[model samples]
Target: MILSSPDPAADPHVAAALLRLQRTSYAREAVLVGDERISPLLEDEIGLTAWRGRWLMAWDGVQLVGAIAWWETDDAVEIHRVMVSTSAMRRGIASTLLSRVLASASGRPVAAATGRANQPAVALYAKHGFRAESDEQIPPGIWITRFRHAA
Candidate 1:
């Protein structure tokens, strides 16, 4: 049962879920990226309103299980964030979002990037057709890998 959220960014339930997910996700990354670098983005009404991307959320009843945010480029849709609730992991939420991105791309490529040491993210992207495009050092010991999946 795939249903679109009426207003993922404004929905109270969705916002709350995303806030918690952000904290947890950043906490995991802080181990490798440092707390200063991996802190969660400030999520406020204005920030949500200013987001310049398409947003999608997966819900199991009223609970948001996953979310994806992306924007269009000249020849690609760039995925900015894809997160699945800790409780809902390994149940295809991420894959479903990736599939939706692929479908909406209309034959263009989809691009995403994550920290080089985030193995789970790297594997998840690989599992969904994304192949490594580049691995670059961002200085001060930070490394990022970009991946692209042709739609």
Candidate 2:
């Protein structure tokens, strides 16, 4: 696997490719959480291109297999998304992408949220030393757990 960082605004193809992977990956996440209205499921290429965050993309040969997006806040790295194609699951792509972000965090803590029912995601964060900090229920009773890794 290979990793790369590319600005979506600087490359329309990057935006489109990420959008495709994001949709499928989040679609699987939506199924895992029993919620079809997750934010990533609703994002489009325009939304992706408009995001002012950094991205780390993973490639298997020429295939775009995974991506993680995040931005730095004053005290932490706020991870917005960790996505891996359904066909590429269990290949350590998500872990690799997330580790890359954590490595570059520069002593800032890391924060992320995932559906409370998404066991794989919850376990993934736990394996990376992130602890569940809070559980928030959005409208329609969808619960999400926020995680934090202290600096």
RMSD of each: 2.6, 1.1
lDDT of 2 at 18: 89
Candidate 1 lDDT, tens digit per residue, 70-116? 88977878998887777778888888987888898999988898878
Model 2 residue 47 lDDT score: 82
TM-scores of all models?
Answer: 0.81, 0.96
Candidate 2 residue lDDT tens string, 1-151: 8899999889988788889999888887788888888889877788888899999999888789999999997677999999998999998988898988998897899999999999999999999999999999864678999999887
lDDT of each: 0.74, 0.90
Top candidate (TM-score): 2
Which ranges in model 2 have alpha carbons more than 4 Å from their true place?
none
User: For model 1, what is the C-alpha lDDT against the true structure?
Assistant: 0.74
Q: Which parts of model 1 are misplaced by more than 4 Å?
A: 32-36, 39-48
Model 2 TM-score is 0.96
